[model samples]
Target: MTRVLALLLLLLALPLAACGNDDGEKETLTVFAAASLTTTFEQLEKQYEDDHPDVDVRLSFAGSSDLVAQITEGAEADVFASADDKNMAKLVEADLAAGDPAEFATNTLVIAVPPGNPAGVKTLADLARDDLQLVLCAPEVPCGNAARTVADGAGLTLEPVSEEQSVTDVLAKVESGEADAGLVYVTDVKGAGDKVEGIELPEAASAVNHYPLVVVEGSDHADLAQEWVDLVLGAEGQQVFADAGFGPPAS
Candidate 1:
């Protein structure tokens, strides 16, 4: 009877021990970011995880406008990063931002075409050719907004074969040969390597998009979210952006 009672007590303690293990479970931090930031943010995610063993970083990438819509519609996110200030402004106006947004980087539009330049897209003006299949981001997206700005500044009108929701979608259309040319950010073109060739647009200077980041209001992990914001605005984070072909934040 004594041995049986001792065994029963051990079993009871085992369950308690198992319950205690849950205390070490990592906290999850969800981040919503613009599609243009995919590469850089992925790199940052890995670094952040390495440095913070107790936190799991989750990233959702999409067009800035789409991301704003998601956050405004009550999607739970700890952090938000926008490809342009206009979208970030919407978040602020909606009172979804926990803090003032910080400008982190800048990007400009470029024309991406398949290898060998099959359509001979040499300049922004060339995008106007009716015979060419041009893809661009929807005007509501940051990339699309910048494209329109540059085109209008040049006194030219663009007629795209498709208007995608994200910059990545525009690049994909060009990469898959679905479109002869697409207006994508310079970072996207650089990240594409030999899959596509980029044609520099002189007018792109007039439409540089400023990237911003902010902590979302009512985040369960508000402290962790602020830490992430600090990391991004810190020296190491800026280095990662620079290595990814992103321009420094405007003064």
Candidate 2:
């Protein structure tokens, strides 16, 4: 009859309406992170997605300095994770961060060489050699700042052939044999695996780098943003970072 047909149409419409409401219920969390954090954060993304099926996570990784610049320019991000304190301070200065940020992990500078060491470079002090070509991050970047600390600690002055915007670029130059030596984060070398070989430097003790994570202002999803921060500061997150060669944050 006509009444039976009307009931069937209403039942179909009810499911469609429920689906529309579910779309609005989705909480998307966006995080702007440092380039060195790429490998570790990938693991974090997977873990978080598995834990919160309804929440979606989007990540953008670059030089911490660049991320800060973008956030200051009013980019829409729910979280900001910096490779160092300097960039995190910038976010605070702009009032872009919600509150006092927390340090999640730490890293140190290392000398990265090509698989064959074509230039025969060695030692932190050897970086001052006139014949060696060096690629380093720009001084404004986190890796560059940490490199400066190691160089200063060793009383060695390095004249680099090129300054890259990100640590990944520095590692790429070394991996491709474009540069004889590169100063990059320890985590970068670990992530690169067979592409590059890393040499530990003792002076890095004086310049240990800290990674900080925070929720940015104007985020429509505050709870999810803070939850991501908690995840980063938690056991699984720390384990992933450590596996990538980063250390515990300084006390």
Candidate 3:
């Protein structure tokens, strides 16, 4: 009787030990992404997690330049996605990126205004009005560069009240009525829906920014990082981006 009880206890403990091992050994893949990709990437994160139960997909979103700075400063991440080629090249040139960054999407700049258009901001030139408060992304940021291209192309010199570090920060100012107008990506205006209204800028065509994605060097989960990259380049990812108002990537 004693031997039988001992054997039963050992058998029960085996599966419990296995459960502990499985639970303790799960993998995590961290992806640093452009701020504009927040919503769509969140959707992709959920989908990837559902498909790969053993791996946790974590995301950190910020301005592309800022994200690159973080990585170059020794931040550990499995993947990097930039809102423009300039920032991606910084990583590639520094040997911090693992592979050729693939162009995933393109975006055009637009003028975002709070609900009701209180400032009556109708065109890019209107942003130059002395009384109208304007916010823009800092020149180092991708969106800011695009905004500058459009402004220069249209021969409109804009005097902004503030220059934010990220495009989302500019959008936030417009949405909260802190600024009368802001220059942001069309996708951001769409993402904000009724909170803000977008005024199309024709010169925006001349300053479209191409977004890129790549795996990071020295990542412990390079294979998983590549898988995430593939997923973003695949049909489902394209559809999600398209639905979010992102344009097709330029060749």
Candidate 4:
């Protein structure tokens, strides 16, 4: 009887261990993304978690150049999403990308000003006004590069008081009233909503930046990383990006 009871206890414990393995276990996927993708990626993270209960998606956002530097310096990232193709190309050139990077979306620069248009920034040319306290992304960043293109196309030479490392940083300066105006992505202006007013510039239309995504070459979670890439390129992910004001990826 004692041996039989012990055997029954062992059988019960086996089921409990199986339950733990099935329900309590999960894997984590680390993603490095551009600062401009913060809001949209956060939403997708939550959605992806809901769909894949056994996987956790962690996101780290910064300027695309900064992200590439981190990855090159041995950061353990499963995926990389760049705001522009230039940074993504850096990874590809280094053979750090697991596969061909796909263009997922496009964005354009817009002038973001404090609420109520306190600086009276009504146009792209207005960013040239010396009296306005302007902020911009540093030239190495995607938004900054796009801003430069827009400025050049419009024949405007801007003298911003501060050059931020990320587009989000530029938006923060405008939102906090530290700067009267900043050039950021149209998606960023939309994300900022009532915190800032967007000034549409026709010149910006000509300088759209393409966003790209790729799985890291050395990632241990290669299958999971590819799934993430598919998720972003799939219809659901495209809808989320579209709702955030991102344009369809170029053919």
Q: Which stretches of candidate 3 lie over 4 Å from their true place?
A: 1-19
Which pairs of residues collide in model 4?
Answer: none
Cα lDDT of all candidates, in order? 0.94, 0.91, 0.94, 0.92
Q: Residues 1-251, candidate 1: write the lDDT tens digits.
A: 99999999999999888777655678999999999899989999998999988899999999999999999999999999999999999999999999799999999988999998999889889999989999999999999999999999999999998999999999999999999999999899999999999999989999999999999999999999999999999999999999989999995
Counted clashes in each candidate structure: 0, 0, 0, 0
* Tens-digit per-residue lDDT, 123-233, candidate 4: 888889889899999899998888888888888898889899999999999999999999899899999879999988778888899999999998999998999999999
State the lDDT of candidate 3 residue by residue for 1-251, as single tens digits: 99999999999999999999888888999999999999999999998989899998899999999999999999999999999999999999989989789998999999999999999989888998999999999999999999888898888898899998899899999989999999999999999999999999888999999999999999999999999999999999999999999999886
**Would you give me the overall lDDT of model 3?**
0.94
RMSD of 1: 2.1
Residue pairs in candidate 3 whose N, alpha carbon or C atoms collide under 3 angstroms: none
Alpha-carbon shift of residue 207 in model 1 (angstroms) = 0.3
Superposition error at 225 for model 3 (Å):
0.7
Off by over 4 Å in 4: 1-24
Instruction: Give the number of the best model, judged by TM-score.
Output: 3
Give the better candidate number (1 or 3) by TM-score: 3
Q: After superposition, how far is residue 177 of candidate 3 from its true place, in Å?
A: 0.9
What tens-digit string does per-residue lDDT give for candidate 2 at 1-251?
89999999999899899999888877788999999998888899999989998888999999999999998998999999999999999999998889999999988888999997877777898889999999999999999988888888788898999999899999999999999999998888888889999888888888888889899988999989988999999998889887888899885
